[model samples]
Target: MTRSGRLSRDAITAFALLGLIALFAAMLNNRPQTTLSGGFNVIDGDSLSRSGDRFRLVGIDAPEYRQQCERDGVHWLCGQEARALLVKLLQGGSIECRGNDRDRYDRLLVTCRTNEDDINAEMVRRGMAVSFGSYRSEENAARAARAGMWAGNFERPQDFRREEQAGSPKGQDLFAAAADFVKRLAGWN
Candidate 1:
């Protein structure tokens, strides 16, 4: 407020900015929740495709397709194993996914079920994936049982991606990693 008891120009600008941010938050919260059901093609441990659309299992992070882990001093393709488990879970069953959000890759972030089994939680329980924002109990159980990746040592998928990107030509990797770190900090991951 200025001497005249009216909002100053800077105060008005700040209020306008705050209003815009609130509106944006409301719009995002109001996005339509979607449910998809059908046979899906497993793209990886945490990704699926039906028809032409891609979906990512919500609140889980799985190994990259090329990731490796060591158990008993022997290297194993943990990424492949994760994908295989997902495939097995989908076998001889109906698959359904529901969500109201999309990831940075534009894939729908969904909670999926197969024949009444929650695939997302199952994956974490089996140690095929780690909890990103959900399934803490399942992850704890998997860790306690030394199941899947919990049985061995491996780089996190996100860490692997960051390292791989950092190895790319020029400084693009740093920029990308910085952007990703910022997104993570902002809870946009």
Candidate 2:
């Protein structure tokens, strides 16, 4: 407040900025979810592209493209297997994805379906992917069955990415990089 009993100029400016931020947040929340439907190009186990737009499947996490896992003392490219499974799931049908959120990478975060199958849940159920935020029951079934990666020993996808980042020339500390990577992976920022 000013000596004249009015809000000072700086205070008014701060309030205006806060108001704008609130309005922006409201607009984002009010936006309707979008649905994308078509044949999709598989990018990885948990991602796909359609018409140049990339989408990350919601509620699941798959291995990095070069990640390896061990089963019965034999190493295998589990990431490639995951991708192949995703491709197999999308075969012979058009896919549909619906969501309003985007990841930091600007890929739409979507729940995808082909025919009557929930693609994300299927991935977790089959153990090609782990449940990130949904499909707990499916993950449980996969674990019980000892299916896919669940049958082997493998690093979690987020842990693998964090280690890779920490080893890079960026010079970030392992703990800090791990924290940041986990936050991004969990969509906390």
Candidate 3:
């Protein structure tokens, strides 16, 4: 080919290569976007109240208040337990926060961790809460297995909420009752 023709071909190739690189960079830039924050009192295994800004836990599922234990007639209140654990672990110091911003209930979704351990995974791995499926499938499964949720029968946090929303069992509200009880204990006048 002529010199001008060869030069034109090279130019086209260079533009194409640059375009590809731009696309790859864009993908990298638009990644999942998990943020980090600190200084929240993780009051329980499942919940935490924040002082300043907080990042939400993205993928994991936590137990609901009414989630019953697979064995015995006792109620564990797995959700509440998860929050309580967070509170206990986080209160000691500034915890790590990484995840989405808000949950369905408009609370922060965060994976909190101390210098000692990750409080969020601890809850699921220890059976206080559940592994979440919406964000990552195997993440939940792995957490479930690790947490020993499979030793017997139980429900996921999402499933329990769905049933409640569907009004299938028409069960009484445990959260409201418990909150009221707590208020009474605190002498809410």
Candidate 4:
């Protein structure tokens, strides 16, 4: 204790040292056990292909390539905007991804970062994406701020797909476009 009855210098220093140690330990514990590091090309807002491997940014869902959303009574190309924003983020540096599972669509599910910034979290924070699997805090913040899709009415990507399938002629909706996208990506067509 001192004049103000607070901790003494030595005691405060000891506590600070302990806090530092704990913070270091926590950082070590949270480090990704496995990571994929390399140059990547942005496939869409939440997807990238690195070294021929397609990875989907886990815990976030962005609009589809052709999906539209209504904002202020006008339709906007939210998907294109999301893709452009992701491209901007990627321009900052290379990305590193870490995760093991693959989605049913044959895309690796991973959390990616450019340097120390989490791309998935940034997308949700900016309203370019909605929390899908886990990342609710970032999405909540964006929603509270009325960012991205939160600014207007928009269908969830999955819901949009379902509706497209149900409403399209002969149940073939957007498949041709998606296939063309893949072909163009792979230089196959």
Instruction: Please give the range of 10 consecutive residues that has the lowest summed lDDT in model 3.
Output: 133-142
Clashing residue pairs in candidate 4, if any? none
lDDT by residue for model 1 (23-69), tens: 99998789898998878899889999988899999999999877898
- Tens digit of lDDT per residue, candidate 2, span 1-189? 556555576678899999999999998799689998878899889989988899999999999878898999999999999999999998848778899989999999999888878999999999999999899999999999999999979999989889978686476756677788899899996
Reference-based lDDT, residue 8, model 3: 100
Alpha-carbon runs more than 4 Å astray in model 2: 1-27, 171-189
Q: Global CA lDDT of candidate 2, please?
A: 0.89
Q: lDDT (CA) for every model shown?
A: 0.90, 0.89, 0.61, 0.86
TM-score of model 1 (CA atoms): 0.77
Using all chains and alpha carbons, the TM-scores for the candidates as numbered come to: 0.77, 0.76, 0.55, 0.72
Model 4 over residues 1-189: C-alpha lDDT tens digits?
466555577678899999999999988767455588867788878888877888898999999888899999999999999999888877678778888677898888889888899988999899999999878999989999999999999999989878888886556676766777798899998
**Candidate 4, residue 104: CA error in Å?**
1.0
Reference-based TM-score, model 3:
0.55
6, model 2: CA deviation in Å? 19
- Model 4, position 96, has a per-residue lDDT of 82
C-alpha root-mean-square deviation, each candidate: 9.7, 10.0, 8.2, 12.4
Model 3: residues with Cα > 4 Å off, grouped in runs? 1-37, 41-55, 99-109, 133-152, 168-189
Ranking by TM-score: 1, 2, 4, 3
